[model samples]
Target chain A: METVKFDLEKHTLREVNQYLHSDASVLDGKAVTIDNPNGSHNIAVGLKADVNVTIQGHAGYYAAGMNQLANVVIEGSAGTGVAENMMSGRVHVKGFASNAAGATANGGLLIIDGDAGLRCGISMKGANIVVGGSVGSFSAFMAQAGNLVILGDAGEALGDSLYEARIFVRGNIQSLGSDCEVKPMDDTAKQILVDLLAESGHGDVDPDSFTLLGSARKLYNFHVDNAGDY
Target chain B: MGTKDQLALVRDPFACKPAIIAEHDDYVAIASEFRSLAHLPDIKNAKVFEPAPKEMYVWKL
Candidate 1:
């Protein structure tokens, strides 16, 4: 039940990060509050403890990048690469997020309460992402594995060149990407959606209302027959 | 607003392209400068080389 506070407006980024790094293990299972982030890049990067961090204002690029066993909550909007390459734990953005949100993260859950920009979940390995609002184009591009659940509309070329990743969109998708196609939502898929929605605190949304998109397996081995689709 | 000569002079000369090699256990390794490979599954070891600032690192995790 310990609470630690860091004021970014009055401190250097390195100093703040140094304090966090030194105290990460000591303050494990505690609550940390970062005030006046003001779109600072690399805030709280490389955290590996089991704790909770709250950023009061907007965060710049790579906030909570490479996170593991920690819960990071951004009270305001986030810039590019939030929660990028996260190993485990959770990252929640209360406001909108910029491009590349949760890019290449292997595990954990990223919940965005507001809209997300382009390339969300691109190259993700195993993370589960839920967006409460719409997402920009090229989301889930080149994703090898994971689940991206978008409650709102998806922009153009969603899930291009994807592999094994599951995408659930409640609203209209502008278009499908190369080798990406819509798939029927089976009972297992519906159950997964239900669990994801519940985990994201959006249990009210109907899982049946969403459409699933995944890889068409056309570019798996990259044959000359499917060169046009590549 | 600057001339080409001035721009070239000011441009960074030591800017070598950054790259990452993420060798995963059961999946194909990913090599990208734009993407991150820190979260890849079953990582036995890792090595990083930085031309700028001149640093080399090896991590075992």
Candidate 2:
């Protein structure tokens, strides 16, 4: 269990990566408080340790891309593709996030505390994205498999081309995607959202305010009637 | 002036179009330049606002 404090002068992504890859276990339980982190792209990539990394400032594109087994938390807003293609572990954003927050993510939990830009969780495989704020249009487009939970309003054309993934929204949806439908919340759905919000530090929310969004399975194979819908 | 009025005035580039007609193309160029400004990294610590309780939206996947 090693502790390292990253100042703006001595903090470079290369140095952070080198320390993470070293046998020292760079950030075991210590708080790696980074001051004035001005949109540094790919701040922590390919970290495979059971450690915690907290960035106290805003981050640029793909801040924690391809994370395997590290818990990364960004205290501020994140730019586009914050956790692109992440395999596992958890990434939490405490502020507004840009486009493609968790694109093509295979697994892990991504929590955004503010509004997210367009196309969030696109082509998601199995990752779970929980947004505490509203999302822009075309969210969950071409989603393969995963769960996207929005606690606020969603813009037009939500979940355009969907697979086996499920989306649950607590607010108004401007429009539904091709073959996407609103279904009754089952016990499993309610419990999943309740637990997710609780784990994400949003336990005070009422779970009954949400509505589930998922693929109808009718257009999963492509049909002529759903052509315009897509 | 109220905050909304100030915002409206700040966002009204067309209000001065007649005076800057000769520089209309330059206005477009300046708009592009300003658009690029949005992409620049925040030099200072970006402000973090509390997650709005009522306006918040969530999607569970």
Candidate 3:
């Protein structure tokens, strides 16, 4: 495969992004490495083609925003909005990520090898996020569709106001958000979890250790009886 | 459709915290309490509001 490298100390974010945009067709089957990122934001935003991007250091914010058909690997941590609004692709972070790791993403696979901060999968739409460590509060807030597999403890208000999305957490859940309830893991759900963990390169994790959380479906409509919960 | 769904589309819920705006010789760096302006590359310098909670903090670099 073709390999391209960009040194953030020498090249600006605009120049790097411009190169990817201009050479869209040529970069489809290539692997690009970014060095000396030094916590720069928006490093690989709006990538539309299939490419492999490897970031050597920490990313500031929105590291892979609106990404599609790309495989992005971050050797270090990521800031807020790691894969925000992502349509499709894969983002693997070897270190911890800050808040809003996959906010509003439509589709893709986000694998975090370390702890994730608040709102880890907020408003997620169809994406699958696998966190190898603990996650902060407000995770899966307003998540309409997707799967969030947390291998460690979850903070308060986990999966608050969640819809359709299924959450699998291994450790203690501080609390469940409104309308989110613990569900028994079925064969189908367990298999799905197992597959996801394997796909995210954590095949050793036991799916049986997870407890499933999903929408109760009782608060879909605003009924007066549920007004207090609302 | 739902309150949570609607709230997700609104402006960041955690904007009331302190913000930092550093203007250097070459580039300007802004750090809001909750949100980040690093995605926008064109902005140079300007007044930034916290949008809610009415506490103001700024730094000139």
TM-score of chain B of each: 0.31, 0.17, 0.26
Q: For residue A80, give model 1's deviation from the true position in Å.
A: 0.6
10 residues in a row with least lDDT, candidate 2 chain B: B13-22
Candidate numbers sorted by DockQ from highest down: 2, 3, 1
List model 2 lDDT by residue over A180-227, tens digit each.
Answer: 788778888788888888988889999888888877788756678867
Winning model by TM-score: 3
Q: Alpha carbon lDDT of residue B33, candidate 1?
A: 34
Local distance difference test values of all predictions, in order: 0.80, 0.72, 0.81
- Candidate 2 per-residue C-alpha lDDT over B1-61 given as tens digits, one digit per residue, 9 for 90 to 100: 1332221112221121111000221121112111122333442322332122224222222
Candidate whose DockQ is highest = 2
Candidate 3 segments exceeding 4 Å error:
B1-61
Provide the DockQ value for model 1: 0.02
Task: Please give the distance, in angstroms, between residue A103's alpha carbon in candidate 2 and its true position after superposition.
Answer: 1.0
Candidate 2 vs 3: which has more TM-score? 3
- Candidate closer to the true structure by lDDT (higher is better), 1 or 3: 3
At residue A90, what lDDT does model 3 achieve? Answer: 95
